[model samples]
Target: MKILLIEDEKDLAKSIQDYLKTNDFVCEWVTDFSLALEKIALYDYDCILLDLMLPRGNGFDILSHLKKLNKSDGVIIISAKQNLETRLEGFNLGADDYLVKPFHLSELLVRIQALIRRKKFDGNNIITFNEIQIDLLSKVVKVHGISIDVTKKEIDLLLFLIGNNKKVLSKEAIAEHLSGDMADMIDNHDFVYAHIKNIKKKLKNAESKSYIKTVYGLGYKWEDE
Candidate 1:
């Protein structure tokens, strides 16, 4: 999954990025509020880790902007502002969850996963569609009860496709989702095609239903047969 962390503390941001990357997440860190707003305006994230206190702006304003844009990206306020009023303001501004600082990384990871699940999969950690099953926490994909030997990127692509089932996802969107805001920096999006091909082959080999559909001139979609 991809996350935009809008935290100002360099050490905490680096530590969070390292830990999240180890768990198969593409984390993009922004030190100031302006950069955070730039990212929010440009790309979509599965979840955003926002800090209320920033050098350039307040995180609450960011949340307000997201609401104004009608963006459905999940947000979690990770702030040192621990007062009830602050927490209430966050949720009222469309924050999904709140995490106070001086907390455990593991807990933060779990919260991110949970928020993603609630936003995308209707609060289910284990996603089940036909014979395919994906455990978000364990990062496992199984077809007909058999685990598939797929790379982490492939798994991420699978989740992205399934989560947006019945919706056509453009190549650009997929690329950005997998690579975060650096999608445009990549030389090309051939890796997106490669991952799609590999996932199709693996699922076919495991006897899973063909659900990924190609839109002739558009992109791809997860359509039911």
Candidate 2:
């Protein structure tokens, strides 16, 4: 999943980024409020880790901005300020969860996963589409109760496709989601095709129907038909 960490503390931000990367998250860090605002306006993130006390402004303003834009990206307030008022305000501003500083990185990782689950898969750790079942916690895919061996990237792609369901996802979007920060550096998105092909083969080998559809001159979509 893609994450935006809006934090001013350099050390803390770096630690968070490094830890999240190890967990297969595409993490981007922005120290200042302006840069954070710019990123939130342009890109879509699965979860956002927001620090309340920023360089130029309070993180509450960022929440307000997200509300104004009607962005449904799950937000977690990762602030040092631990008070009833602050926590209530964050929840009032549409934050899904809040975590105080001095917490474990492992906890933060699970929190991000939980928020993304709530947003994308309706609060379920296991995602089901017909005969296919994906265990979010274990990162495993099964077809008709039989386990299918797949890589992490393929599982990520499967979730992306299934989450969007009938919506058409462009190659650029899929590239960005899969490659994270390196997406811009990579010139070709042909890898997306390869991943799709492998996923199709695995599913078909398990006696599952082809649910992934290609839209010529556009992109790909997951359809029941």
Candidate 3:
């Protein structure tokens, strides 16, 4: 999943980014509220980790703006203030969850996963598409009752495609989802093709139905029917 972390503490932000990366999540950081506002308007993210106090503007304003725009992106308030009023205000503004500062990274990750499940997958840990099954928590894929050993990126790619079945996903989106904002600095997206090919080969070997279809001169889509 893709996450936008709006935190001003550079060291903490870096640590959080690294932790999420290790756990198969693409995270982008935005210390400046203006830039963050622009990004939230332009692109869609699965979740937003917002800090109440920011450099340019407060996170609550951004949250209000997001709601005004009818953006359904999940929000998690990560602030130092742990009072009831702050927490209530966050919830009133439509925050999916709230986490206080100086918390464990692992705990934050768990909360994020829970929020995503509640928002996107109806709180299910396993995602099912036809005969194929994916365990979101374990990051495992099974076809026809047999386990398929695959790379992390392969699982991420498959999950992304499955979630957006029948929608054409461009190479750029795939790159960004898999590699975060740093993907933009890359020269070419040729490596995306390699990952797709590898995922297809694995699924084929498992005797599962081929679901990924490449759109000519565009991108790829996943559809079971």
RMSD in Å for model 3:
1.7
For candidate 2, which ten residues in a row score worst on lDDT? Answer: 176-185
Best by TM-score: 1
lDDT of 2 at 162: 97
Write candidate 1's Cα lDDT for 1-225 as tens digits: 999999999999999999999999999999988998899999999999999999979999999999999999999999887999999999999999999998899999999998898899999989999899998878899999999998889889999999998999999999999998788999888888888888999999998888999897688999889
lDDT of 2 at 11: 97
- Predictions: Cα RMSD each: 1.0, 1.2, 1.7
TM-score of each: 0.97, 0.96, 0.92
Clashes of 3: 0
Candidate 2 deviant stretches above 4 angstroms:
none
The residue-by-residue lDDT of candidate 3 on 105-179, one tens digit each, is 999999999888888778889988888898999888999978998988888888788878899999998988787
Between prediction 1 and prediction 3, the one with superior TM-score is: 1
In angstroms, the error of model 1 at 163 is 0.6
Q: Quote the RMSD, in angstroms, for model 1.
A: 1.0
Model 1: lDDT of residue 130? 89
What lDDT would each prediction earn against the true structure?
0.92, 0.93, 0.89
